[model samples]
Target: MKAMVTTGARQMVVREVECPRPASGQVQVKLEYCGICGSDVHYYKDGKVGDHVLDHDIVLGHEVAGMVSEVGEGVTDLKVGDRVALEPGIACGKCIFCKSGHYNLCREMKFFADPPTPGALQEYVVHPADLCFKLPENVSSMEGALVEPLSVGLHAAGTGDVKLGQNVLILGTGCIGLVTLLACKARGAAKIVVVDLYDKRLEFAKKLGATHVINAKKEDVKKRVDEIFNGEGADVVLETAGSVITIAQTPFLTKAGGTIVIVGQSAQSEVSYNFSEVIVKELTIKSIFRYRNSYPVAIAAISSGAIDVKQIVTHEFSFEDSKMGFDTVIEDAENVVKAVIKF
Candidate 1:
């Protein structure tokens, strides 16, 4: 098997490695596609995400989907030749959080590409059968790979409890931001407003069903959002840009008594926010850590033609050109939305 390994900051090389076989209750998948996440770019460019630094050479991919080549003992539901999407995180099933159905918050999670755990950038990956969600016949492998990120959007919108005919304000136009827009739109948001620094991304957001778009670089975000919603503010404000500024702007953009969902992960741990505005508005603020129980929802949404997950792809690269793909993501961040590596 061949894997793309990050040797150091801004360094990646293809290396021959041992192909992993599945154990009992697991399945071996012949990886077909792996999406490059923002965290992957961070690890490739800076070698760390927050405190989870890259201490050694590691495979760098998590958003993945493929066909089952072998099924281990005790794996009855899924069989060989079945296509599936692998949930990257493997949480301890015995934890209190897991028992309570909030498994995404489990403390003993071994998520793929997060430091010590090697990611699924290779040709073959063996994962637990329970974590692997079988894709519907209508879904493609590329779309399967996208289920991972789409799960985040589903979780965010679900957390905010976005209802039909409500207004939404998305504070970013990145892949995650766009997916959140799709999720909100699918939930029947009457007006979806997306804000970003790049005009191209904002245009893409419009094509993805954004009722309105704001380029923060050209105009004032808060002022434009107010104008779009006619000073009433959005019913739900989701911060997916992971910017400290956007995170702080949530309170002001959300409607009184509306919900604010912090979906982005900022690089800086601490951010200055206005608690007075939150108190005056009587707003409900919520946050998500990865996602729990969203894979099925995302897959079903895509399968039902409610969410077009495949439209998010802006670039694709062959497995051998994996380094080039990572470099394109870093250097051409504005142009490239989502880049996938095909095995």
Candidate 2:
């Protein structure tokens, strides 16, 4: 088996590694596709994200889906031939957060491509059965690979409590932002506004049902959003850019008493936020980690064509050209919205 290994900063290569076998309550998946995530390129280029640094030569990919080649004992619902999406977070089921059904917030979680955990860039990965979700017959393996990111979008909408006929503002046009657009539309948001610096991504967002697209680089995001909302503001604001400025602007851009959900992970530990603006506006600010228990719903949405994630996939590479895929994404950030590695 071959895997993409990042031995050092700006260093990556395809190396032969032993195939992984399933442990108890786990299954070995013969990977068909793994989406090259932003974090993967971060680890490959800078060797770290915030405080989480690459410890060992890690295989870097988390958005994974494939067919089950082997199933361990006690795995009854899934069989050897089932195609499934692999949720990359392995949480300690007994933790307080896990016990409270917020498994994504579990303190003791081993997330793929985060640091030490070897991710799904390999030919075969042994994952816990509980996290392996079976794909519907109508869903393709490439679509399965997108469920991981789409789950984030669903969770963001759920956290913000978006509802029918609400005006929503998304402060980024990345994969998560676009998926959040789909989720909001599905939840009956009458007006969805997407903001980003990239014209291509904004155009893509408009085609995907966004009522308005704002180029933050050219137009005033807050003013434009105010105009869209008739001089008030959006009912719910989703910040997915992971920048300090965007995170700071969320409270002010949101309507009074509206909810602001932070979906993107910021690079800085202590972001200087405007607490006075939040207090004055009486806003509810919430943050999302990764997703929990959202994969199944995302799969159903993608299968039903409610979410067209396939269009977000702009580039695809074979497992052999994994390094090139990473490089291409890092170099062509604007042109490549989503990149995948097929085995």
The alpha-carbon root-mean-square deviation between model 2 and the true structure, to one decimal in Å, is 1.3
Against the true structure, candidate 2 reaches a TM-score of 0.96
On residues 1-343, what C-alpha lDDT tens digit does candidate 1 reach at each position? 8888899998988899898989999999999999999999999999888988888999999999999999999999999999999999999999899999999988999999987998999999999999999998999999999998899999999999999999999999888898899999999999999999999999999999999998888998889888988997999999999999999999999999999999998889899999999999999999988899999999999999999989999999999999999999999999998999999
Clashes of each: 0, 0
Q: What is the TM-score of each candidate against the true structure?
A: 0.99, 0.96
The global C-alpha lDDT for each of the candidates, from Candidate 1 onward, is 0.94, 0.89
lDDT of 2 by residue, 53-78 (tens): 77778888999999999999889989
Clashing pairs in 1: none
Alpha carbon lDDT at 117, candidate 2: 74
List where candidate 1 sits over 4 angstroms from the true fold: none
Worst 10 residues of 1 by lDDT: 220-229
